[model samples]
Target chain A: MFSKESLDNLILSKRTVLCVGLDTDPAKIPAHITGTTKQKVMEFNTSIIKATHKYCVAYKINVAFYEALGMEGWQILFHTAEYIKSHYPQHFLIADAKRGDIGNTAERYAKAFYDEMPFDAITLSPYMGIDTVAPFIRRGKFAIVLALTSNTGASDFQLQPMDDGKPLYQKVIEKFSEKFGRDEIMFVTGATHSPMLKSVRSLVPDYYLLIPGVGAQGADYLTTLSNALNASGAGVLINSSREILYASSNDDFEEAAAAAASKYEF
Target chain B: MFSKESLDNLILSKRTVLCVGLDTDPAKIPAHITGTTKQKVMEFNTSIIKATHKYCVAYKINVAFYEALGMEGWQILFHTAEYIKSHYPQHFLIADAKRGDIGNTAERYAKAFYDEMPFDAITLSPYMGIDTVAPFIRRGKFAIVLALTSNTGASDFQLQPMDDGKPLYQKVIEKFSEKFGRDEIMFVTGATHSPMLKSVRSLVPDYYLLIPGVGAQGADYLTTLSNALNASGAGVLINSSREILYASSNDDFEEAAAAAASKYEF
Candidate 1:
């Protein structure tokens, strides 16, 4: 599990806050990797992880992609998490499973991600409020709450004004920031919403922000870096999923992925 | 897959709206059921479902408890879903996995729950707006959105006043109800907040509401039933997990669960 200091040190040492997202879709795997769907996916994940580990300081594994593969998917998910944790201990690992529930259930989810699988951080939905987040706020573990997303649907509720005259996302960031420190909490402020990232940084100046939507979602990387970085020049984990994972749809996938990851150097 | 018409029919035929929640904890299993934790959990789930199926019109499987068990836990979950679905085809099955993510990721989750597992509905956290839910609103399937939860932290955000003077939950219900019909969507209005049930009923008179916090959470059953039911005399699936599940941590646990489930007749 990576703490704030450890994460900052890693970021400074690596000279990049690039968090390679393993949102691996089996259908997108190159035809060259022949086996059952599960085997293909496992091969793709390990290959991608091996190829891109040095270019980035973290790996964000989206649970949905593996889960979609059914029982075999869970097997792949478990193996993938272990592969990353044991093989690359220095890299921060995130379970991009945006799960939110009541307290008791939340504890189980926290256990599933942090204990069952070795994820340093797990993304959470704060709509059910702070108790849903409390179970995951352990030492050296982070509960990355969704503040403002990159999706267009973010405007539907996240941008809606509350009684305090600020948008709901601001209130979420404000409230959660009060409960947990920079070590135990981070906010998912999307790269597409770079201008708003300044406001997010203002609220929690030192806390890391996991920024998605850099490549496929069309957010300018330099703009995101300029607006989101903290005084230490290390506060954002810019994730590129499909852009790097499926950088090439052919036999040269490993090389293509490596090249693509290196191209996003901070 | 159970729809509004089928759910209503089942409720009328069974003369109850009870949804027995399988929030199974391995440690809580009876010592008499001797095996590995996975086998114990599987036996417990099968026995419970068999005993309570006659009394309840639906079953709500909380994903957290199973996910907590790690790899073998998923096997238990897969088997449990298959057991109830194959044996009790008439009952509405729900994955109480308050999952919320962006569009593409949401599609994969929808596939995981609805396609991979034979669930008729899934509970969703609506904070990310409609896109997180759009994937699950298919024909004969329902998307149960979180309107107001039973947790103490609901006051932190769900009950807060938005710019329109209505609380965020009301706005969520209003907006979602307009987009999806009664057959396609249901709201999770907690039983602990029964007084607000009238407001929810007023907004979507025909849509079903999955009410938690009934037994162990200490909400009066009669009050919840009277306030939440529609003109058709059916609309709520009142869920009771702990009280019914751990009715007796002994040899007679099966009969105890049946008796406990029958006591909560709508």
Candidate 2:
């Protein structure tokens, strides 16, 4: 359970709002790690964590890359989460799973991430509505709903003009905020949509926003920080995946990852 | 890839619109299996598949249940998919994995289910927009998007009235239908919302609907069939999970599951 106060304390003490995204791809890793896909991914993750943990406050493990590998991939996911929890207890951990279903199914997913694996937060898709998300918001765990994604496809339903003149994403943020407080709920607002960050901040000024698309996806960090920063100067966790994880394909990949992470310091 | 014509042919040949949901829970399986979580789940799934495959045309595997057991669970999931594909290739396999993300991430998920596992179709959440869904609609594969789920939480967002004098679910159906044809896409409309089936049918009059919430969820089957059946008399694949999967807790569980499944025959 990463309380708002504790998250803020980490942000202030670490002097960084960076959340390293472990979107580890087996095809992209260096040729030096001659092992099975699971072994290579785990080794890569451990190295990256060892080098970058001091520079960032959180680690976002994208579930898709692991899911691509089948059962072996899932083992890597569990090991990675366990490694983070056991080694860096102070760092907030997120499973960037983007999962939601019916009430019963949602409960199982919540248990998978929160109880079985012990992640502090899991990203959720809000298409199925409130009940799909309610199961994730317990005492300490948080459900970060996708509001404005960084991709071009976000304009499909999320940016549609509703009857009230507000875009659909605003309605999503507003409705979710009504049910959860700053600690239990967060919104995934992409860095590409940095201009809209002010609008998002206006709606839920105190809530934490997990901003992605900063590095590899080519979103301006200065613009995002200018609009998304809250009164506490600690309301957003900017995630950089490929740019930091695959900083170099050489022997100094871990050192390169750490150097890239340090560039995101506040 | 389940073509509209082939799927319809199977529906007629099987003489039923039933899809047995393999939501195999380790805690719910009969004690006689006496195996590890992964082994027990695989055994239960195999038994149920053998018992009920003759009565139904499709098998919907809810990914969350398998995801709960970590990597071992995923191996069971793969084996289950393989069992159905090898022995009952006629049966339409739906990976009830309600997954969607950015375009690149969504592509990996599609490859995971379609290329890696050989599921005919995969359930998707459309909250992120068109790019999130376009990756899943390859040659023979189908992307069944969640429009109006059968859960109580559907009221939270899916049932909300849009500015165009239509519920949000209707808007979702309309937009998706415009982009993908009936062959490439399907919609998940819960059977519990039987009254809305008429409206949904009217919207996507030709597209197949993967309707859950029958049997155990207390949805009236006759009403659902009457409202959802299209001109071809094959427009819906009704999914019932718990009612059929856990029909008995004793030695007769497999026989009971078959008997329970036979009752849904049209």
Candidate 3:
């Protein structure tokens, strides 16, 4: 049972909160690795991971990359996640999988992302209310719900006020945070939403936030962090995936990646 | 390349609308299947698929069964969906993976559910707003959003009024039907909400509805169907799992399953 304390400690000791985003598109995978399929994905991820393990505290494998390729993709995803767990066991692992459903339906989702995939945490959408989210925040694993996301379209409704005068996302964070969620719950805030981080920090003063949209998504680290944390100073899992992973395409790719990761230390 | 039209026609011709829920739990699987490892899941699902292909119109393999066991669970999930798809090529295959996310994130989620898994449709939650849904309804793959769930807690917020003075679920269906959706978007209306079905029907008259909460969950099919159908003769995909798949522990399991599947006509 990899606890949240363990993840937080890993993040602390590592000094690098970079969740190496392995959203590897096959075509974008180094040319040598493309045509070989699953094994190639594994080999490709292995090199990148091995090279940058010293710099990152987490590895976030987007399930879509593997799933899009069918069996080969899934095999690669499993192998890739397994490789990360076995090799960099101390690093936080997140199945960048956004899964949510009904209670019975969510039970299976919890199993897939938490139990089967063997990731420390999984991304979740809190749309169908607390029941849809309860399954993911079970015993050991954490469920990172989609709050104010990094994407440009988030403001369309996530920030809109509900009939109760609370914004929809605020209702999500406040309501869902109360349901069976202790340290197990986290939120996805974009680095781009640095402006709203202060209000968000006031709302969810304690829960961890898995912030995307930093690095290649053009979110500034210090500015975003300043807005995310409350009086507690413990709730920001600042994630920078793309810019860190592809910091350089040269033979010194790993070094470039490490440098990029180092740029976001706590 | 599996068109929604092909799936619809097959469902129409077969006179069955049952989406066989394959929520496989390792403890529940008969011991005759090997160890509780990945192989057993794959093997058990294969056997179930082979034995019950004749009776089902669609195989809804809830992602959790495989996910709970970890990597092996997903492998089983992938192979099972592929196996069932190959075995019953005409049957509509759904990943019953209720997935939704913010827009860009939703695109990745969509690829994972639709492109990667190759399921004809995938379940979703619309609480995040229509922007969160558009990606899933891309091109031809149908998006089954959770409209009004069957759970006791569905009343927690789904029926609450939006700013527009419409119930949240009604607004969701109406908004979904008018926006980026046509016939490709459907709703997951609980058969337990039989009386409320007509309201759902009147709201989105042309869209399909995947009605679960039958048999084991306790919803009368005929009554549910009568309420769910609009004047267009559309809507209603009644799903039954544990009640059908495990209808009997004896050798008559598949037959019992067929009997259950027989209950749904349109």
> Which scores higher on TM-score, 1 or 3?
1
lDDT of 2 by residue, A1-266 (tens): 68887888889889899999998888889889879888888899999999999999999999898888875777888999999999998889999999999888888888788877869999999888877899898887789999999999888788877777777898899889998899999999999987898999989998999999998899988788889988888888999999988999998898899999999887
Name the runs in model 2 displaced over 4 angstroms.
none
- Per-residue lDDT of model 3, residues A118-204, tens digit only: 688888776667777777765667788888877655765566566877666777777777775556788887778787788877877
Judged by DockQ cut-offs, the docking class of candidate 2 is medium
Which candidate number would show the highest lDDT if scored against the true structure? Answer: 1
**Cα-based lDDT for every prediction:** 0.91, 0.89, 0.71
* Top TM-score prediction, candidate number: 1
The superposed Cα distance between candidate 2 and the true structure at residue B45, in angstroms, equals: 1.1
Model 3 segments more than 4 A misplaced:
A1-16, A32-35, A138-140, B1-13, B30-56, B102-117, B127-132, B138-140
Give Cα distance to truth, residue B206, candidate 3, Å.
Answer: 0.6
> What is the per-residue lDDT of model 1 for residues B1-266, given as tens digits with 9 covering 90 to 100?
66777888889888899999999998999989988998899899999998999999999999999999998777788889989989998889999999989999999999999889999899999988988899988998999999999999999899999987889999899889988899899999999997898889988899999999998999999999999988889988999999999999999999999999999775
Candidate 1 backbone collisions, by pair: none
- Tens digits of per-residue lDDT for model 2, B201-229: 99888999999998889988888999999
TM-score of each: 0.99, 0.98, 0.88
lDDT of 3 by residue, B4-43 (tens): 4555666667766677888876666565666657776676
Every model: Cα RMSD to truth: 0.9, 1.2, 3.2
For candidate 1, lDDT tens digit of each residue in A155-208? 889999998799999999999999899999999998888789998998899898
